[model samples]
Target: MNRMQLAALATVATLFTACGSSSDTGPQPVAIDFKALVGTQTFSCADTAGYAIGTGTLPWIPKDFRFYVSNVRLVDAAGVEAPVTLDASVWQGYGVALLDFENGTGNCTGGTVETNKSIQGTVAPGSYVGLKFDVGVPTASNHLNVQAANPPLANSAMYWSWTTGYKFMKIDGLINRATPFTFNFHLGSTGCTLATPGDFTTASCTTLNVPSASFAAFNPTTQAVALDLALLFAATNFDTADGGGAPGCMSGATDPECAPIFPKLGLPFGTTPAGSQASFRLVTK
Candidate 1:
């Protein structure tokens, strides 16, 4: 009785150990790095002036730079994709994240000391050869009340109000000239309407304005995503302020100033077709 009982217990313990070992490998942490750049050089908040940009190569003082990234996915060598389940935190939550490049220094007065430089999350344990994500918050997440929203969404600097929803991206710069003026590129969904006067939960926008990108050769460990301000403003005139929604593009469908900028975001404005998104590109970390 003693020999048989001991032998049976040892066999059961071996099976349990093997099961535990297999179950231990559930998911792996995946982080895709990103950077804000002004062409070849990495961007810094201390540089207040003299960044060459725009059609005429005019100098401008960079003020603010922040944007959201969502629906992150990792792609395999054979083109199969898997969504990265984002870890909830102050900089990321509810399927969205704020990639803040400003640190409240120099001319970036509206920025905060805190900054987030990467999309942090986990994916199914496998080999990923590429990355893909959206450049804005989704509709269900975007059309909610900011006061009642979660982490990154509650960041007032990245928000507008109830009716208009959150700003997808906010990049501003003051044209360095005799009559210096601020050019705000506040992008969000426009042509929205709420069933009730102040109920943002009921708001529906005609234009979603969310741009997407897929990098076929991205290696999360050895590469980084670069958001190039120089490429963004390449086709835009920094000096001119069209008589439209704001001094610069405000995601307004009919704003002439927004027409050129939206295409740079890989978004279509008015009747113009969507141009290739030149603002985002790959770079070595």
Candidate 2:
């Protein structure tokens, strides 16, 4: 091979290497900030500072509630949804696993006060289309043996031993009328009858599964997701003058309160009304 021909071949080889390198670089991933905004409402009598709701002092009334959301799924640009399951074994330093409301508490059996709590996670850059998750604890995990329950479950405060289940929703606050008062809006499974006298025995009770709701359209880069407590009890049936109270709704059934309040707050049901159906939207930058 002549010197000139050898040089030309070397140049061609270098150019091919550069082209291959560029092709292998692929697309860069962007950083995405994801958050879960959670809040609750209160059914209180009227006095001055609107209806008391959430964590506050000297208002109409405060109804404080917490939710434990896990096993979150994120949708990507390719129209593919990815599941982001977190370590549900603990919550905020407390030991409490995920709670399945459907199957009762027997499946896993024990938990902590912090069990089934909601937390936020970081998402990578992608065009998220929608989100999906279960609302209540599934039946398999719901009906666990309370005697063998862990810390939070062993606490007994959250458990309804008499009824052989747990309360899915605890809506409590002070109610005011011509005066001031309190209202307890606790909903869960009732009419429970045990099949056998055992630690994790099945109960004759059943829970209702409410469908999830879609709250908003979100783009992680351009928007933010937040849960507005004000919208939760906007239609609450409470009046100070008349001692008004919110209409009761069964937890596992198509309760009136669950339908009106949840949907207004951005949660909708698809087929089954047990869990919530909604995607987190980017509300702020």
Candidate 3:
């Protein structure tokens, strides 16, 4: 009555242990948060810089700041890419999220009063040595019909249409003169070709200015990614207007303002700038 019963109970216990171990071996889901900043200051439309970019010396006052990031992933020490799943919402779609730091006050009329301070997503739980992502929508989702696209893309302020595609990063502000003049930087693909305006098909743009980044240290739990506005506008003159009448770069190849910004974003000048990225930092708390 004892020996056979003992053996049966031992076999059942071993099977249960094996099943438990197998179930816990897969990757666990983790949440990662990204915070935006201008230098060390918490980014806000109300912030102002005493001086403008370059020698023209227009008074700088931040009015609006927003951008998009996509294809987010984490890199382990062994150099393996860990895929992340983004939370889908009005501000997020096509594997990307739109970050808006502006609240439509002062000189910023194109933005909303509500602001988005952080971006949250889920990734496999692990110690990540690096973080990688794109600055704009990829070609697969970039040139779609804006009316039919996701909420982030459908917004008229972010999309220009089939000829121009989406605005990758929009940093707008006022450079005070007799009146407050606008200094806008709308980054996106340029020189696109399509059969017609109404066609929903994708166009091949000569410059897909989707700059990205790879950081040495990125842990969502302990670090926050920052975008420094001071460094970004250092290369441009806010007072000077180019042939197009805009104060700052609009991803134009010939725009002098774009030269310094290209390197900052890790993109090659006068090219598509597809595989280039730089301009994300990890801040430890």
Q: Which candidate comes out best when scored by TM-score?
A: 1
Tens-digit lDDT string for candidate 1 (73-125): 88877899989898889999879989999899988897899888988777775
| 1 or 3, greater by TM-score | 1
Clashing pairs in 1: none
**What TM-score fits each model?**
0.87, 0.52, 0.80
Per-model tally of clashing residue pairs: 0, 48, 0
What lDDT does candidate 1 reach at residue 142?
83
Q: Which parts of model 3 have CA positions greater than 4 angstroms off?
A: 1-27, 48-56, 162-164, 195-198, 239-245, 271-278
Candidate 1 versus the native: TM-score? 0.87
- List model 2 lDDT by residue over 1-285, tens digit each: 677765654443333221211111232222223332323322222222444442333233433343333334566546576554343233311222233221122221232223232333323323355554433434444467766766334435456556666554444444555566444444454445667766445665643332233333444444434434344454555552223233333342444445444544344423423333232333564
| Residue 245 of model 2, lDDT score | 34
Q: Order the numbered candidates by lDDT, best leading.
A: 1, 3, 2
Model 1 steric clash total? 0
